[model samples]
Target: MFFHFILIFLLISNSIQNIFKYNLFHHSHPSEPKKPSNPIVIIPGDAGSRLRANLTGKPSTVHIFCDKTTKDYFDLWLNLELFSPLIIDCWADNMRLEFNVTTGMAQELEVVLPPSRLRTMQRSFTSSALLFPSPKLWGPNETFVITPRKNYSLSNIEDFFTDIEFPQGLEQWKSESPSLIIDPPGVKVYCIYGSEVKTPEQYIWYHNWLFPDYQPYLR
Candidate 1:
């Protein structure tokens, strides 16, 4: 509950700061209401905060080759090169948070502790990894329900429609999708999505070098 309030405060304060900056630089209307001079905290966005991981020690891992410990904190989340082919799993494993029934909290397998529990701030960190902000942390809200889904999933319905054009139809379809059903809207939906970006809809083939068309169905 407290965390949610802090986040809401940050967003509102940052928005006010932007308005003040605009008023400070541009001409204000004669009848315009006075802007508040209150201070503001800058809103942080994706990849804004740096992340580092240090391997304390772990009992064992499924993959014997996976690093069990690191001498110092190393870059964890920010590297795209790690996501190539067979290497992606290792990168993800490093960031995976396991729920602990004993502690009633998630931990990084007691292996990589940075993302799970951030301590000191670092400027030298390579990639800025996201600390999982569990919805439970922000408490409940009546306005909306946010369901966390897999980072990349074969959930795009249009992706399935595109597969009919290819040699393999539904045979190649892969799914870890939450659902395929779409209910008719009962309330206003203010969709905010990227239009120019060509998102992957069909999975013909993928290579690290060649990026594919990215688009979402415009309703």
Candidate 2:
């Protein structure tokens, strides 16, 4: 009877030891940490990011005709009055006429209003009309106009074309360990362009100039 009791006690001790050993091994050798998903950050192409005139307190200045003299012109072009596909076609025809005349101007005055600038202005009008399709969609009261910043400096917008900087905070985020990557990658950036727009090449050129360290995918 004494021998049987001793044997039973030994069996129970060995089972408990085995269970503890298994748990300790698992605790010490956990599964590999999961790789984090990279985050995405989209930076829009020309006139895509909302811009406001610091001087005028107006938003979406990209829609505004920069050199229009009369409110009527602003109403028709900037406010997008009587905006339709047919109207856009007529406007584009008029712009082509204007481009021809402007390109013939003497070199001194051409410096002030370059042919390139005129073409961009023409494209902005037609692109907006096509993208929005309806005046109500591009209306002044729309949240798309109101939700973005009201204090973007005109000079800043101009400067962005030449020297835009990546946010410094994002640089730090990119340095984190691979496992900690979350839903969004540490730094996600997209440069969006329209098929009709010719500015993508210029944008890619400047983007590369600004961020030579990183190679961005341009699609």
Candidate number of the best lDDT:
1
Give lDDT: candidate 1, residue 184.
61
lDDT of 1 by residue, 102-197 (tens): 999986544334331332232122222111122322232321111122122223333433532332322222221123335667988898898799
Displacement of the residue 202 alpha carbon in candidate 2, Å: 11
Cand. 1 TM to true fold: 0.29
Whole-model lDDT values for every prediction: 0.45, 0.35
For candidate 1, give the lDDT of residue 92.
Answer: 60
Candidate 1 residues lying further than 4 Å off, grouped into runs, are: 1-49, 108-219
RMSD, every candidate, angstroms: 23.3, 30.0
TM-score of 2: 0.16
- Regions of model 2 farther than 4 Å from truth: 1-69, 72-93, 98-163, 168-219
Tens digit of per-residue lDDT, candidate 2, span 108-197: 112233344344443344233232212222332322211122211222332232332334322322233222423655687696877766
